[model samples]
Target chain A: MIAPALHLDGSARYDGTPVFSDLSLRVPAGEWTCLLGPSGVGKSTILRLFAGADTGADFDGSFGADDGAPLDGRMALMAQDDLLLPWLDLRANVAIGARLRGEAPDLARAEATLARVGLAGMETRRPAELSGGQRQRVALARTLMEDRPIVLLDEPFSALDARTRSQMQDLTAETLAARTVLLVTHDPAEAARLGHHILIMGPNSVTPVAPPAGPIPRPVDAADVLGAQADLLRQLRGLPE
Target chain B: MSGWRAGILSALLGVAVWQAVVWATGLPRFILPGPGLVATTIWKSRALIAEHALITMTEVIAGLILGTVLGALSAVGLAASKWARTLVRPMLVFSQAIPVFALAPILTLWFGYGLGSKVVMALIIIYFPVTSSFFDALMRPNRDWIGLARVMGASPARIMWHIRIPAALPGLASGVRLAAVYAPIGAIIGEWVGASKGLGYLMLLANGRAKTDLMFAALIVLAVFTILIHAVVSRIATRLLERY
Candidate 1:
């Protein structure tokens, strides 16, 4: 599917407290847009808003596909929690979207998706039997099986150990390559490594942060990547440099 | 130890304790029959006890099936609709507050002195526990899974069928296990209130005739039956839990 760019211009309030106001952002079509900010800045809320999920907040805004189409049924989401149903094995979990929608799941396709996520031949393993990283891979496989044009990830790799987190970043960057991806993260290095267009969201405003010049799934030790990571860190910390 | 071996050992211990109590109390044989006397009576009246045991078993099983189905449906309905929750949950709680055991005589009067009254009694006794536990679990599904299903564009019915129901199976299993133990109580009470045949009715008959040994045998059969049902239900519940 050709990914459509998305636009959100509005404000939201949670329990009568303002989450964000006058927030305007663009997720350029078919590219990675990383949203970075401190906790409670509503970065994940924006992702929720775009994914058509309940944000537990009253939102008054215009958010839609750049193609002027409704975003429903064209989106998939991955959260820090893998959200695999414990009762179902890996393949069934990967095909859960179709099953939940009352469609006959394509088991062959689900197996292939698992293989794509490097979990080949583990189709019958329950979520409990797998390591945390393996479970996240199953989640990734589920997300990929949906094949939606827009994918929203809320700190999907933050729970992993340092090494596993970096590995996951690389896999996700490669797998979700052509989709309209919006990643919400608090990790500066993550944004620097994967974001094609980065936006640092403060309490009330959204500002675009320039990424280091390179192809995404960027080398971890690259000089510009480290520089960009440090700069994003400083910017987020309100530390002028 | 194997389960059967442990169970046999426990039964032996219980019998020994019962025999000791009988010897210590020196109660009249009619008042407290010893294990040996009860065993002899059981063997001699095996056919008679079996006939009555069959009736009570039928009542308990029928009640269990009916209660489990009705309770499961009520729980799912409550979970699925806010209207059902608002309108029915209070009534369910109110029903529980009315002690169900006290309703046995009335149930017998309405359903008559046969199997129907016994079954209805069993159903009423177990309905609330099954509904309450299953409904509570249904209401509190894993939030993240529900969110994920919603984002996948699942309809409410589809979500309930594929997610909520399966997630709540363990809860439902627990309810059924509880119902197994409680079902015999309902059936026996209904039989006690008014019945032509059943283990409960036989015990009452034997007591009136001062055939205490026969009454003791009947009581032992009832106890053994209840324990057997509980063990079977527990095994099934554990398997269901493991599978789901």
Candidate 2:
């Protein structure tokens, strides 16, 4: 699949306060771009803008695919909350997008995706019956089942413990390799681990930082990842590097 | 203890207390029938009481089914549209402001002194709780679930049916439980206003004829029937909550 480049030139205001003004960025096709910032720097807002999910914000933007076609129905967003329906079991939850689209749920494919997310044999368990990490995995499976060309993630693995978070990061980086991805997170190390190119959003500007030349998920203890992590942290703290 | 055992024990204790009260009061059987006299009356008039009880039961069941269907639909309508909420909801609440007992005569006047009047009475009494409880639940669906559904491009109708309704079912179940207890009150009140063949009418006839023991027997039968209906509704509600 030839992934389309996403371009955005936008300004957004929340409650009459400017979040970002005249902000422009280009995401190359089929690459992972991580948006890293402090807690309230509007990283997730940018992702929401791309996903068209920020309905209440005063946003003025021109967004388009590289081919000049509309972007509707081509993007899927995995929000920070694992918003699994409480009434459905894991399999049905993963298949919800298909069901919502009025298509027959591909249960066999849903089961395979659940297994890929390491949620095998728990297809009958509801969200409330699972652990936090397990629920997050189910949410990930749901996003994967969407099978759209562009994916937006908002702090997708923040709920997982260290080991499971690493596993999920690796799995996502592998599974979503062929799609355009824009991820939002506050974790510098997570950005370093998964992002092919990292964009740091400061109070006034977004700065692009070069990461090490390796496919993610890079070894957490790898020398290149650690170096990029340090540089990312330095940029976040407003230090010259 | 399990529910049945506990219920049986409580009932036996209530009967013992009633017998003690009768012995202590030394009231005459005409004005205040003893437990023994009431018990004998119940056995002897079993056939008459059953006939009336069956009629009352039919009215209560019919009213419950009709009211629940209408209430559930009204709640869905209220949840689905702001216009419905603004227009219909106020009228529903206003209907309750005039006491339901007051409406019994009006309903009897409109529906006539038959099952129609009694069923409408029960329906009127039950409508508010079912609509209110279900509407509250539907209006406040889990925000995260709604967000996810929106992101997935679910239509508003789809979201309401697939997500909101299923999520709000426990609240609907609670409403049904309340309706079970209230249905009989509406039926009996309608019978009191005007009816020919129901427990309420039988009680009134026995009292007018100064048959205190027979009236007590009819009243006891009504009480037991109410408890049984409540138990059945509660059991179904519990199962629904568990499944969904």
Candidate 3:
């Protein structure tokens, strides 16, 4: 399915204190949109809103797909924690969406997806047996199995080592190609490398930040990517560019 | 060392110490029979002791099964509904404030001196630990996993079954371990209050007749039985932890 563009314009408050008011942003369909900001700037709250998760705050305004339909049942999320059930094997974890919905899990499809994520012949291993990167690969496989048009990633690779992070970035980008992905992250380098359209969010407003002039999963040490990364870091630090 | 070897070595050491105490104290045969005399008494009265032990064992096993099932069900019920948690949780806590052992006489009075009262006694003793531990675990599932499951469009019942209950199995196993140790106490107390059979009744009968050797033998049997139950339950609990 072709991804639908997401448009959200809303205000949020917690315990009668406003988090952000008149915040508006659009995630273009079939591309990556990275929302980067300092911690506690409601970046994850925005993703939660799109994913239809409980935000633990009062949200006022309209947010929906530009196709004029609700985004429910059309989105999958990958959080900082892989969220794999420890008791389940890799195949079972990947196929949890079907089992959880009381449908017969397609075990063959789960095995195929595991192989797609490069976890072939390891489908029976538990999460505890896998390394951080391998576990995240299983998480990626689970997300792919959801088969949704929209994917929300909330710092999904933030816990990995630098080398593993880059490798996973490449894997996720390739596997989720052409899906509408809204990635919320604090790392400016990640935004510079992966975001097709970038938005820098502060306490009250969202500003468009132009990424490097290239496709996503951009080389880390490329001159333009480094320039964009430095510019993003300076912008985040509130310095004159 | 292997568990069995360690256990046997401990038992031998315990018997040696008991013999040393008997020799040092010079107590009368009726007052403190030596380990040798107790062992002989156990052999001589094995048939009689076995009869009473079978009764107590039956009571304990029945109570363990019933208590575990009831406690697990209550935990799930409490986890699934806010009303059950609000209305029943406080009642559960209040019930624990009343010492379960003190209720044995009342239970015997109500259910009579038959197996009914003994089973009820054991059930009451174990019900709280199992319910509370499992309920606490069910309420505290991994937030990220639950969030993911919710976004997957899983029904509430499916989430409870596939996620919450499985996540809480270790907690339930812990409760079962505690129940294994406590169940025997409840059954024995019930038998003490009033019962035609059971190891507790045998102990009291021997004591009344001044057959202290027989009394010591029965007490030892009861202790051994309780330890065996705990070992088995512990193994089961460890398997639950490892499997999950």
lDDT of 3 by residue, A1-241 (tens): 9899999998999888887899999999999999999998889999988877789889999898999977878999998899999999999999999999999999999999999989999999999999999999999999999999999999999999999999999999999999999999999999999999999998888999988998889998999999999999888889222
The lDDT, on a scale of 0 to 1, for candidate 1 is: 0.93
Give the runs in model 2 whose Cα sits over 4 Å from its true position: A237-241
Ranking by TM-score: 3, 1, 2
- List, residue by residue over A1-241, the lDDT tens digit for candidate 1: 9899999999999999999999999999999999999988999889888877778999998999999988889999999999999999999999999998889999999999999989999999999999999999999999999999999999999999999999999999999999999999999999999999999999898889889998889999999999999999999999321
Over 4 Å off in model 3, which ranges? A239-241, B2-9
**What value does DockQ give for candidate 2?**
0.52
Return the top candidate by DockQ: 1
| Count of backbone clashes, every candidate in sequence | 0, 0, 0
Candidate rank order under DockQ: 1, 3, 2
What tens digits encode model 2's per-residue C-alpha lDDT throughout B1-244? 5977998999899889988888899878888897788999999999999999999999999999999999999999999999988888788888889998888888999999989999999998998999999989999888767766766778889889889999999889999999999999999999999999999999999999999999999999999999899889989889878887
- Place model 3 in a CAPRI quality band: medium
TM-score of chain B of each: 0.96, 0.97, 0.96
Model 2 chain B lowest lDDT segment of ten: B143-152
- For residue B75, model 2's alpha carbon misses the true position, in angstroms, by 1.1
Query: Candidate 2 versus the native: TM-score?
Result: 0.93
List the lowest-lDDT window of 10 residues for candidate 3 chain A: A232-241
Query: What TM value does model 3 have?
Result: 0.96
